[model samples]
Target: MRTIQPIPFRLLLSAVLLAPCALPAQPRGPVGSVRGTVYDSLTRKPIVDAVIEVQATAQITYSDAQGRFTLDSVPLGVQQLTFSSATLDSLGLYGFAREVDVTSDTRGVLLTTPSFGTMYGRLCATAGSPSRDSAIVFGTVYDAASRTPLSKAQVSLRWLQSSEGGKELSNPERTTATGDDGVYGICGLPADVALTTTAQHDAIVSGAFNTVVGPSRMLRRDFYISRELGQAADVRTNATPSSGSGIVRGTVRYERGKALPGALVSLIAGNRSTETDAEGQFRLTGVPLGTQELNVQQIGRGGVSRAIDVTARDDGTHDFVLRGTTVLATMNVRGKVGADQAGFLRRKQDGMVRVVEREEILKRSDIGSALKRLPGLRVAQKLGGTVIEATRPMCVGQVPIVIDGALIPNPRNTTTFSVPQALSGTTAIPRATTTPAPSRAAQSSVVSAANNARVDQLMVNDVLAIEFHPGPASVPMEYWPGPPPQCGLLLIWTVASNWDK
Candidate 1:
């Protein structure tokens, strides 16, 4: 509107060209939000007062008492979130590091912080004294079938020790390769601690050992690796298959015809053991073909044994009849089933319980898979991961999931939409009847499921045992101190001992 614009053509052109740069900048685009909860993998409990931070960003928040956290204004795209709490770290638990995609608003992000347990053992030659201390744990890995020492095998030791203040401390976890002599060892371990030892070789099944270290005691532990049937067959294509391996299937029952679950069945020579299922059934694979002695023992029951001639690839059934009598004075079953108050067998007897021990859990990759095999339980895949649901029709409230004596919050549906129901009448008018409000039972179920932890986050190898109760009536009194689940309960114990399995 001013006459200055017409002062000169050069000035006018320059002003027009510089208009954009001189103007104020436009506001940035809207940012997204991230919200979730952190849980203990072993205990399945929410971690309160935990700090959650997004990497490379200023966004941070601490979890509330419910273990819930929200990070607002998080830049959209993939972001790595970390969770930490001093209380958890003091108990030998580490923080969770997870990468999440945040294209928009996000929810139901579950992170699990795993705790550490100890295992200790010594490695030895087939006919030699405990290998030297340096080589005690690191011994030549061998193929169980071929009995040939395997070189370049990997050995690992993982454990957590206690500090002077009675706080748990985690080790850096040691791993090493087998030497030319097939010997290996892990150094710098705390004395008198429990640890988990594993040995892995090419094409061979890995071996896992659980034991505790005694003061200055050299505990000899050996690895006998075996390939699966298909793998072993392929490796021996040019040679005859070994005749020393086969499978054994059997059942354990009381003389009164009642099935005895949790019976420990072991092959005396093979050192392989397994527990019976709910139906008192047991299957032991890879038993050496020959005259083998089978020992079967159960808590509060007398031990029994039988001699059997196992044939290569044989599949047959052998049943044991255990008589209920006074605990055998010299049975020595206490060694297998520990006297600890938290022992799997002891807790199982407290209620109608089904247990999955450490050995069975290690055979699977994740706890979900191991749980899927249980009877009367439905393991389904949801948006996040596998979840367990009670298959019994009469169940009501959400099934409670407990780990290491900690109750995990259940997942929940946020919406309140209700489906229309059909009503029959001989009238011309169409009724506009609103849906009925949810019953108190239904409301409780929603709340329970909403607060439960995600079960898929739990690792199978880290679990010591699992207990499943099909209904509230079967849940143990100890697990019912709070609001009891109307449907059922699932309890998981992860603070493992050397006696587990």
Candidate 2:
């Protein structure tokens, strides 16, 4: 160039650095993408908001409402795609993963939760025969109120199986512990048989969650647990298992056609019971939590006993199917508390106690209604059942109930259960040292939970008479089996007194 002779080395370097000429394009490694859809194995429905990750890499994407996802600029080569979501995380399930070749956009990739095949492979790996005869139970245990996963929850499963030698055997109880993910699984269970399962965490335990895995051999049951009212836990004590209670509502009907009205239902060994309404529907509350046996009274059918698993999140529903006539009849006192008609008349004529005669009982629909006829009693609708208390308004608005002189146990006696043990890997609720004074609602709820809805079980036809003692002064020794209640006693006269039992 002009005057370029004898240019300095420094000047030549500066010119090259300042030059605007384009050099050969630098090379880059190949980059690809991943596209796929996520779904639920049980429902076979698309799962939205699932996060897909290119493992060991920085690329990540989330599925849309349609469960479709795409990840661009994934380094080309073999890559691991992981899928996780709130739904999966809450179940304590680690996300699913797959190895994918990422030479180009990997499209049409489908994913799902642990499918039947996958679960089978994992559960039945050591089981014999690779057959679908054995069932697999998998689910998450969670807090009933918060709906959050409960870590370290214990799930108990019990089932009866037939052994190879034609012998009926009770399988060793299968129990599994849940991790922080609250996920649990049991494999190789007998298919097409009823299995009872319960979940427990510290002082909180769920009612029985009975399930049946048919020939399909896949059961997904999500159990919910809660601390029942009247239970108190202290960090100093080991949490005892709760015999939690729940409300069971259902209808009785003839399997062939319509509702069976006036049908009587009672919890076996539990006085908290009820009778079906005119519509054949009944709502029974405060039944103990767990697998409870129910006795249904029907004429000529014998007393039918049915097993129902009472859960914390009870569907609040049940349906009883009867085969015979719906022409309701008198209750069977086989093992129930009944009355002595002679003694009832004797008490009535003595005039020492307030007596509700059959003529009055027959006019009302149920005993609770008949009890309302008494002037010294307070009857109020609460928690889907009739609650009776003395007009004195003491004793927290509840009185100990007696039927046929059989004193029903008062739930208020043991209002406090044990606290959480805080076992390893378990996330327990913290014990509160200080609590605000309970509101009236709280007070009412405690009373309601402690009192049984006895009105639902006895219809007017079943009762010959009823007696009420308004105070300790009037509670006779025969009626008050235990310490005389401050609020007095109620003696219900049934068709057959337990004296016959």
Candidate 3:
């Protein structure tokens, strides 16, 4: 270097060309990393075996059982992180896309996933008999694009009954994992009603929905899933003659003023009948549009018939009032229990219990008003709608509103229902009326109701009975399925009649 002659042009160019291959690769400028844990937004529990991938990079990793993931050698700049898992997708839980910065080694990043809407379909071998005892709903999960059945796919089946007064039913029986055949099934399902199925596979897009186990004795419904995130599969089913139908809504009441719960409201010419709810409300869906005959009957009050004009859209409300005494002559109380007797026995059996009958519910326009009649329960207005609170204070998540046997999840917490401010009377407020602050319990119920909006979906006329237990100690074993609520429990039972023909 001290006295060397100048290098020739060709040799200098050659050295310059080889320079990039030498010099220790410039030390890579301190490669960065990213780490985080994935969690279920609803359950707030860590997800296990979830996968994490870096966009625009070869770095990818799977989450440990604790839902923890780590990626090293990430480029030092803004980077997008994607998460996925099969277990989560089957339950309708979907991961969120996150934009993360990798300027340095990052840690403790929390990613939450929300549940996607469910889809519904039916599986049957033939169209003649849709109901089969011990019938199996089996299907294969395949790559949407590749058309290959996925292995280790998770298929879950849940009952799709309406929550008595809560959110949609989420009663899972068991989870079936696909094997090398990529096939799964749930047997011994009740053939009387439809069932819901969900599918999930690692890094594969999943879907959930209620499925109609059609009459086909050995029908199969296959699901093709995609790798794209945040998308739910659309529900598909065979069309029926009554596919394009409408709904009929209304209330049945005693002539005096009381709403009639438990009254048999049937379509005269059709094989469809349902009992009125605690609010004396009733809804008949899948009703063919046009003129329909309605028949209302109660054991003691007798029966009445009327004609209703229905349309394909915009549900119509009808009110019926019977001209008879509310009291039924004391009979042996045989056969099915009468609506009035059901309400009376519920009250007579327990002094602490507060019963909301159809008659009372029908009197009120909203569920909040119907609940206000319960002792020690207060209803207050909020930004969304009226919230129910217990006069006796309780801890967090103590009071759970149960419909039928399923607990109603708070609508606010679920994506299923959206509480319209309009329904809660929170949209337009009058300056003259000053609303008081809601109690903690009341605020919680309101939020729960708003979040779940199950109460709002309940037509007073569809409720058969409602029972309020002030606290855990008061809840009956029959009504309390899982753990007892810490605060109190609201029980709602809907009318389920065997009128389907």
Question: By lDDT, is 1 or 3 better?
Answer: 1
Model 2 over residues 350-417: C-alpha lDDT tens digits? 44367888897898776677777665577777665677776442134466665664555433343322
Ordering by TM-score? 2, 1, 3
lDDT of 1 at 473: 34
- What TM-score would each prediction reach against the true structure? 0.31, 0.37, 0.27
Residue-by-residue lDDT tens digits, candidate 1, 42-72: 3457889998877657458999999999898
* Candidates by lDDT, descending order: 2, 1, 3
Per-candidate alpha-carbon RMSD to the true structure: 31.1, 24.0, 26.8
Please state the error at residue 85 of candidate 2 in Å: 19
Window of ten residues with lowest summed lDDT in model 2: 1-10
Candidate 2 RMSD to the correct structure: 24.0
lDDT of each: 0.53, 0.58, 0.53
